[model samples]
Target: MDRPLVAVGSVIFNGDSVLLIRRLHPPNQYKWAIPGGKVELGERLRDAVIRETLEETGLLVEPRTLMGIIEVFKEGYHYVILDFICEKKGGELKASSDAGDAKYFTLNEIRKLNVSSTTLEMLERFWRGEKMPFMITEISK
Candidate 1:
């Protein structure tokens, strides 16, 4: 059986500001989520995260720590996303057509925004250096 997992990163800054995007797809349309995609074959996890962020959000990133891991069951597939806490290296940040728009936000503001439940939980666990386990959670259909 496959591990059914992939590593993901969330670039955050200033203790409260996190990089978010407005997705332009079926899964997360109009919701503010982290600027990351999937881990590519033969690519390093760090490279994948940075590349995905750049491609999706136009921001160069340097992930600092492994925040936590989250398992999501969505759209008839299981995904394990390794959430990384990151900092910006350098880039002129903008939103790609893949993601509607990119911006930074405070913790309170992000909490009020339409963020995915898993994303919010990941941030919460990561903030306290707590560990999360592999478990199933149904996604919004």
Candidate 2:
């Protein structure tokens, strides 16, 4: 990688559950996380969130609010991720794109799964109704 890449992701809620995808690639492959990917060139951040969610989870979503930002550095990978809390619109839910699996998980279920650290922290802060646009930094070997 040359420069810090910008990515967008969504935290979608269906009733009391949140949607998540098991990534099929690193920097956190095979672990459940929010559905999103790298933003495309000239794409608006909100548009990227919507598109990424659809691409990974097979569900259409509308971005509701900017939850926070997470910067991750691990194994020679760096990603500055903007996460939005979104409202589910429509479309059947399935795993696609770089997602090995997709599903809605309750908070209880989430705590039991092998989730990306950023996802866990973001969701925890969100559930606590913390301030918006918070920042999280995670570095791993």
Candidate 3:
């Protein structure tokens, strides 16, 4: 890894469910996580989150709130991820880009899947009615 890359993720909720994608790339391959990717140069954080969500899950999203930051370090890769709460504005749900699968899951169902810890923790926090802008650090061995 070179310098830490900046990325953005969106947490879209529908009633009691949350949207997740199965990653097709390394660092967390095959793990269910929020739709996201590294930001392109000069792109705004909110735009990156919206674009990434659409690219990965085929859902057009409108970012509603800044959820928090997640700093991840694993396998020599580092990412500073800005997470946001997003609302689905349009488009159908389907896997594309670096996502192998995409779907909405209730918290109970999510606990049974191969979900990223960071994602699981965040959802748990959200469900518990915890405060926003939670800070998280994930260092994988």
Per-residue alpha-carbon lDDT of candidate 1 for residues 1-141, written as tens digits (9 for 90 to 100): 256657575656655677788888745568888777778889898888888888987778887777666677665556777667778788888899579988888777878999888777666655566644433354654
Instruction: Write candidate 3's Cα lDDT for 1-141 as tens digits.
Output: 669999999999989999999999977899999999999999998889889998999999999988878899987889998889998999999999999999899999999999988888988887888866988999987
Pairwise TM-score winner, candidates 2 and 3: 3
lDDT of 3: 0.90
At residue 22, what lDDT does model 3 achieve? 94
TM-score of 2: 0.95
Give the candidates in order of lDDT, highest first: 3, 2, 1
Worst 10 residues of 2 by lDDT: 123-132
Clash tally, candidates in order: 0, 0, 0
Q: In model 2, what lDDT does residue 39 have?
A: 93
**Residue by residue across 1-141, what tens digits does model 2's lDDT show?**
888889998988878899899999987888999999999899999899989988888899999888999999987988999999888899899899999999899888999999987798888887887966999999998
Question: Candidate 2 — what's its lDDT?
Answer: 0.90
Better TM-score candidate (1, 2) = 2
Instruction: Report, for every candidate in turn, its global Cα lDDT versus the true structure.
Output: 0.73, 0.90, 0.90
Task: Quote the lDDT for 75 in model 1.
Answer: 57
